[model samples]
Target: MRHGWEGAVLKLFRGKDFTFTVTGAEQVTERYRRVHFTDGGLLQTLGVHPTMWVRLWFDNAGKPHQRAYTLVDPDVEAGTFSLEFALHDGCASDWSRKAEPGDTIEATVQGTGFDVPDPLPPRMLVVGDPASLPAINSLLAVAPKLPATIWFETTHDSDDELPFRIEDHHDLRTVPRPKMVEQVKADLQELVTADTFVWIACDTTTTRELTSYVLKDLAVPKDRVKSLGYWKAA
Candidate 1:
């Protein structure tokens, strides 16, 4: 399928396209699904980076709509990876819900990159929702040695069942949706250090609010912070 204007813009910027074949799929929860894929030489060509993502093409009313999903458990040597979808009433979620082995999808790799902090932070303050779980995992996996305080805001009952890799030194706090931002603020007040690294991904409003707080109110330098809204709340 032609990707429409958005795809054209990405192509103008030299976005590389690839086809991914679904090797397997599983329902992680009623609200979530996991799909495994062979990267079609993507892993070997572009290599891998922390929190790497790709824009997946989906059909929305016969028009190509793209959604960005972070790569989960990317195995470069095997040229395989898995993507977890927080199911909802959307074309992307609909595709994932019915995805099975042998299904193929077109994807573009563009506007996805991650840069680790020049000097590892003394403390990590992470905030996110289920939509950003894969990214949170990738960031933590790349910096397991640093102590982290994770604020995971839960919207569905199954969110608590999601996997989190918490070491002895790491702290995980599952917050109700309404209280997430305040709780994170309270924690950051105590945890923010000269070299504290803050990461946030949630609904658009919350992400913007928290990003402003960290960069302005808390005085965290831009280089020490990373924030992006994974989805917009309706």
Candidate 2:
């Protein structure tokens, strides 16, 4: 039998050290940067397959931070992929801002098993903060032509740059940062129906809260709501 998309192993390229050169950077928002890597050999060695999740490890100054980010656009033919970073004054963000081309950084390869829904429901809910945007966007790209309700809670208005195609039945609602849970709760209460399937990603705290709301308050079936905790506050 052929291996399904879930079991593919992308190449795992080891850099000279835990440092990366900044080939290019684009300001998606005051708190986010779109960084591109140019080490073709490293990517090729890793055998990066489409839709695989890549985890980058680096130390800022002396502190270590491990961040999991997906490859935004993986061009196997060109040997390039984009990783979007949520800029924090923290170590990882500090290093990313200072990286330039020819710099080296250590990265690990991993695969994703989260299955996308089939025969999409009439309306669906996608909820998360900036960190979860990439996964949410990827999910949306392949979603069926049914209605979608997207609720994004961002730290700043500038951090609201989503580069995915939105169909006619898709609705995007943005609420300011620090209030992700509150805003998402409100949206779910008003918009969710018995048949709606909900996908949520965010910090640990918000994930727990949203999961409880969906499974307890709204009485949504366990299988209909999916929630993930991308990170925890320091």
Candidate 3:
């Protein structure tokens, strides 16, 4: 399948391409699924890092569509990893729902990297929804000992069953999409310190609003906070 212009742009930027074969799948919940894949040598070629993600190309009615997914449980030696999908109405979710053993998908790797803070922060403030849950889990995995306060927005009742790698040191709060931003703002001053690391991955609007508030209103240094809009609201 032709990747369209997006593939061309990525190629110009030196994006590495790979084809992943689906090994198996799991139904985590009514609204979520996990698809396991042989890495197609991606791990050996690119290495790995926390929150590592790759763009997957899917056929959308003969048109190319791509979505970024974070790698879950990546095993370097085995050249394997799993990607969790928060099932929704879209081409990416559709492909994930029907993916079976031996099914292959094209993937591109570019602009995916993370560097842990030199001196670990005393605390962490994180915000995300199901769409970014895998990345949230990855971030927390790297700092298992760090105390973290996480706000997860829920759109469906089944979202409660979404796999979250929260530890004893983590405080998790579930909020409706409408209340998430306000709740975070109300608690920000107390939770965010000068050295507190804040990571947010949500709908584009929410991510942008929270990032602006944290950086401008609270005067947090840009380097201390990581923000990414995982998806756009419909």
Best by lDDT: 3
Worst 10 residues of 1 by lDDT: 161-170
Task: Show the lowest summed lDDT stretch of 10 residues, model 2.
Answer: 1-10
**Pairwise lDDT winner, candidates 2 and 3:** 3
What's the TM-score of each model vs. the native? 0.97, 0.77, 0.99
lDDT of 3 by residue, 1-234 (tens): 889999999999999999999999999999999999999999999999999999999999999998999999999999999999999899999998999999999999998999897578887788999999999999998879998899999989999988989889999999998799999899898877768789999999999999999999999898998999999998
Off by over 4 Å in 3: none
Ranking by lDDT: 3, 1, 2
Instruction: Name the TM-score of candidate 2.
Output: 0.77
**lDDT score at residue 44, model 2, on the 0-100 scale:** 62
Better of 1 and 2 by lDDT: 1
For candidate 2, write residues 1-234 as lDDT tens digits. Answer: 111222133333222222234577787777777888754454566654323566576664554445678777766677676778788777678777876766666664444446555546678798877887777767676655767888887676576565555678789878776777887887788877767788888888888889999999999888888787888977
Compared with the true structure, what per-residue lDDT tens digits does model 1 show for residues 64-117? 999889999999999999999999999999999889899999999998889998
Model 2 regions more than 4 Å off: 1-22, 38-51, 60-64, 160-165
